[model samples]
Target: MFKEWARSVRYASKFHRKQEIVTFMRQIDDLEIYANLSKFLCDNYRQALKILKSEPELKRWMSVEGIDDYDTFHVWLEEEREYLMGMEDGLPKKREETVEMEYVKRLKNLESSQGRLSSILKAERAALSDRADFNPAPISQVACRHAVEHRNRDAELVQDLEVRLGITQQWTSESPEWILAEKSIMDHRYLDALDEIERIIVERLFEMTKIHQSGTRYKMRRHIAKALQARSKAIRNAIDRYNTVAEEMDPPKPTLSWEEVVNYGFLAEFDILRDTGDSIRSRPWTRRSYRVAMDRYFKILRAKEEIQRLNIEIKRVVTWIEDEDWFLRRKEAEYKDLNPPLAVQISRYRQRRARSDYNHMQRFWALAKTPGFTGSVVPGVSVERQQARHAERASRPQTSREMEMEVVDERERWNSSQEGEWEDDDDEGEEAEQEKVSTLMYQMSVLAVDQDDGRTHQLD
Candidate 1:
């Protein structure tokens, strides 16, 4: 019996301790604190949504809980507050001993309801915080915007260059060099296409340089170079913008580390006794602030990607230009070395040969017009003998094999005659004949050079 009495006393002591703990919890009004926090979270979420709605571009970046949940929680909080106010109003005007137990029971039920509501509020706040922390939609939206802007800017710069070059026709296909290069590519002559493009670029550079030297108004190279400079400036501007946004959006670090905030309460264990600390104190950012920061961060990433691509493209073109410039300089030096003296000789030779040909033609015509003329117009040849020889040769009948052999012999004789023509000339005439041969060679070279120049001008 004494042991049973001792066990009852132990149970009574435990029950009293639990009652004191409950009373202390109720006095702190943790239920009200949780409700206020939930309301604060709801307000922030609503404000963020409003801002997102105003900016359609930014709307795609927000990922959060639905408004209906917040609405429901708010309605419940309001109803519970009204019920508590009504209960306070209905409290007896005079403290009646007979109604004390009833009042106590009603108060206990209200406390229980408050406890349940506080738990619900705490759960809601946790959900909202988790959503705010983890969403990446804002970052994705910023990155997409950055990439789009960069692409548009690049296109605009390219269009401007095209306009300035007067090659703005659709696809810029009207440029003869481009057309030839494109045709070569279509023909599966990749090396030819590359050569054509390189040649055109070198020619343009050379022409521009010549124009500059002559103090002319040629601006094609200047425009192209300007566009390249703009591209470089755009890259720098993008990088600067990215850096500025990053600095602007970067939030100050929280006083407490994440580990500390999670492991210990806002005020450590003291928060439990005081019950006045807020969970939000541990976090540095709200949902909207965090999202905006992430957006800027992602924008920086996209800018970096675009900058890298631009750098590669610009570097490739610049390298090609440098190589073409070197090639152009070398070719110009070669042309200067070989053309001037040779061209002067060829020109003088052509004038003399033309006069000689005219005189020979006039003499031949005059001799033909003479009534009794029988001699060949050509020097050292008899016309009658030449005609008789041709007639005898034509009259001779021969088998196909003999005919073929005769044709071969004729070719050999013609070749030998041409080879001995200069050798048969007297020493006094030898130098003149050699000059004629050299003039013929120079004519062929001039014709080829003229054709190439014509083609190059057509390309221009």
Candidate 2:
């Protein structure tokens, strides 16, 4: 109190005690600054009274901290008066005419800065505590409830945005992992806009993997499997497309040197066994390993029906040829035992056809599946992959909507705060509007009440 008394005495001394009074009206300069100062004072009056020494910890208490126009003389006056009331006429309202002129100046400033200040304007409503003949605007009880509803809704929206922002942070942290995983299968570069899509894809993959490992392995089993399969197919097809394009890219157009092939910008010209060792196809064990791998690959292929038919024909031919050799020798001496000569001739022709087919089949597969010629077509392989490729080629990348942007646009439209929008439209009563908990809740309640009230009023 003594310190405050001493400070006041000094402040009083700084001003001239003149008889003229000068009417000393410089325009308030910034009405926003005044409005802001009043709010800061009312908000932080108690904090200044209990000022602490630690600068960092006392930031909120000090005028330098948080958001408020600390430089404004009006704000400084307010901080003092807030904790110490009846402390003179308290930050005198600028002389009426000058205050009006300053307000006009600030009003004009709003035109260019409206978009920037939209959030600030809506947010400033919470700081209104001055009801002393300055009844800012007529806010009715019904309107107050609506304002509260709006505030609550806005709070929820802010909280949701905050949560999403946190999620975005977590997503950003894991983005490199997503980039790596996507690159593994996609062979594509990164896009900032695609962060959401990439995160979702990685998260989906993780979830699918999780589901596969979890006991939900049984509940909705088919649905989960289908989702996983769909994603896997998309990735595989994307890879296949990449490989196809890569193959058509001139096959690297290698400028092979006498000593080595140059790959990856480096001259790996010092391979010890480049020309000395047998190729994988010529080596016996290497040949066997390839055949084993090829068998597994073909079996896994779904549309191998045509290849299976060819295999059946080969098997039938081989079986017929084996028995016919013995049958023909036995029949040569036992012609009298034959039911019909025509039937016997037919049987002989079948045996000859079988022998010819077996040799023909061997030659076809010799080049195709042979170990040394592994670059050729896979023998007896199904056409499923070719069909799938055709199907994939028919589709293309599709566009999706930005739902967050859409939601924001909706909120902005509703939040426009038109001059008289809060006026009650209800013919029933303002009392009814005052009681709603949420707008969404209110809407539902209205419909429910209308239905119930209709029935009750008819009976009454």
Candidate 3:
């Protein structure tokens, strides 16, 4: 009877200990989930703050929705993150009976606190979601959610809609309308004129290329080219309008010289010279004509600079697209194998955005390539004089090595003259004259040494 009682007590103790361990593990899993949720909420809060700070209009909208004081909200989020991190760090590692009990109690308290915080976060997220203009989630997250919710819909159409929606969101987020509103009427008109020019150039290019490649189509091609030249008059008119507006807004000050405005007369050698002939010096130049010439000259310089900038931007965008394409392609192949619907949708959306950006850049390149759209002729001047002046400036000795060589040559000349003087000096005053010469030479050597030291420091 005693043996059976002891066996029963042992069995009961084992079962109870197993039950305790199982409960402890369940608490651990729950705490881990709570920690993850806390991290997620913190990230969302951070993203929200970033969005609000960037968009003042959105902040106003949110204020209307009763979520004012982002600074306080940001502080609260930071505090919550730190509190959760502390909780995680303070969790017990040892599995002693006393430590386990203490850990369980702590976890229970943490659970209650986390539950309350989670509820608050959920309510805050709901408030943000209620505002149509404010979405804290990234483009990918939004697209993924949409894809998951509407998996039964047409995949391609859904993807396209997501891309369009993303673009609309981006456009609104940038608030270009506000930016345009800040510009003057003249600026708006100038932009419209530029758009018209771009449209004309694109149409002309399309018309010229629409014909088949054959000998029979030669006349058609010629007709198209001639017709496009007719549009050149329209282009010229638009450019005149643009120039008038630009000159008004940026008017050339009297202090600016022709060389300063026209990149040292390099631009004068172009089509401008053809239109004005060699009459720049011969004509009775008035202030009005000077201002007009300065405007056209500056426009040419601006166009050249813009073209170079656009080329660099295009190259950078192309490189970015290539890298993005490689990454998305790999992601897409993985998605195909795994058949993860949301991942596939997100990848497609990214690819669409990249393609759209590339097309936009290419259009910009086309617009930049169109000539005679920026401005008309620079005042004609003597190209030979300009060339000679530019050449003289270029040929001037400006390098450190050249300066050093000049200094060495001067020192050699001085030394040779001193030697000749010494050879001619009489013995009576020779000692005194030699001392003076030595003193002068020492000073020159000291200066040379100082200059050499300065040059060495500059190199270093």
Best by TM-score: 2
CA RMSD, predictions in order: 47.1, 49.4, 41.8
TM-score of each: 0.14, 0.19, 0.18
**Highest lDDT scorer:** 3
Clash count, predicted structure 2: 0
> Residue by residue across 1-460, what tens digits does model 2's lDDT show?
3354354345443444231123221122222332243233222322322221232332343334243432332443354334234213323112122322332233333332443344445544545544334343555444555555655555455445446444333222145643344332221211111222222334344455667675765767677777766765554444344335434333221122211211211111222212222231133212333234323333323223433443344434433433443245334324524544643564455444434433433443332222211111112212543353345457843212123223323433433332123334442133123222223332443355346435544654
Error in Å for residue 263 of model 3: 32
- Per-residue lDDT, model 1, residue 166, is 60
Q: Considering lDDT, which of the candidate structures 1 and 3 is the better prediction for this target? A: 3
How many residue pairs clash (N, CA or C atoms closer than 3 angstroms) in each of the candidate models, in the order given? 0, 0, 0
CA deviation > 4 Å runs, candidate 3: 1-286, 335-339, 354-358, 361-460
**Cα lDDT of model 3 by residue, 126-218, tens digit:** 767777665455764555455444443333343454364443332221455423333433344444543443344445435555654556377
- lDDT of each model, Cα atoms only? 0.39, 0.35, 0.43
* Candidate 3 TM-score, C-alpha based: 0.18
Q: Between candidates 1 and 3, which one is better according to TM-score?
A: 3
Whole-model alpha-carbon lDDT for candidate 1? 0.39
